[model samples]
Target: MRKMIHSKVVFSPEDLIVVAGISLQMAYKIIKELNHELEEINKKEKKNYIIFRAKIWRKFFRERYYDEKFLTINDLEKKFKIKEWEAKEIRSTIKKELVAKGFKFIKGRIPEKAVLEKIYDYSEEERKNENVSKIVKF
Candidate 1:
């Protein structure tokens, strides 16, 4: 006699809620939104299943959350190529500057535009130093 074993691959909405740190209602709402998007794609491409894959959900979440205006610590580290402590220091410095300029600083997120501007200024300084070194060598 031969026995058959079946594997199930399921990602419940609750799992999405937990992973996304959103409410149960929000999880269902996001699922509905994803389903609608999938349906549109399926209709356009004539695909069979109008289902949401885990990979698709992750992409959607990242796109919705991590945009130019708002960035997490990981984004800062990757963009600035800095250690975690350095990233925190940069964030703190920027926040203080913004507060001094009458802007309110939010916790746990840094403004991407401000961080990018700082990075650009730092790069420009480095380029100037390199040019000065070349002139001194000559």
Candidate 2:
């Protein structure tokens, strides 16, 4: 009987065919291309996020305090205790966002007299409906 010793770096004849391999240059190129694509995607995502955030902010503000009489920048600053620049930015962002969302926000002065009444009426109706639902559930 003859004994054969196999080296640690043993390979079959098929191993000489050399399967697919990537060089350093090709790897760098692929990485650079991926990075470029990621940057472009991030820019687009940022723009979309800004546009969506603006729309949401406008909607929430309007729902909470939609004044037909648009609040002036100064009034907004004072009311929110923010800087004049911030107020301007908020108004601009809101206007642009609302326009994008197809909500035409026109600047007009409405009488304050009926606003309070309307708000009270809306609240009362909401409360009544809530109570009715609670009773029905009970």
What's each prediction's TM-score? Answer: 0.39, 0.30
Each model's lDDT comes to 0.60, 0.40
In candidate 2, what are the lDDT values of residues 54-126, reduced to their tens digit? 1122222233223223455665666658897876666666666445654433242111212333324455467
Which pairs clash inside model 2? none
Highest TM-score, which number?
A: 1
lDDT of 1: 0.60
The window of 10 residues in a row where model 1 has the poorest summed lDDT is: 2-11
- Count the clashes in each prediction: 0, 0
Residue pairs with colliding backbones in model 1 are none
State how far residue 55 of model 1 sits from its true place (Å): 30
Off by over 4 Å in 1: 1-68, 122-138
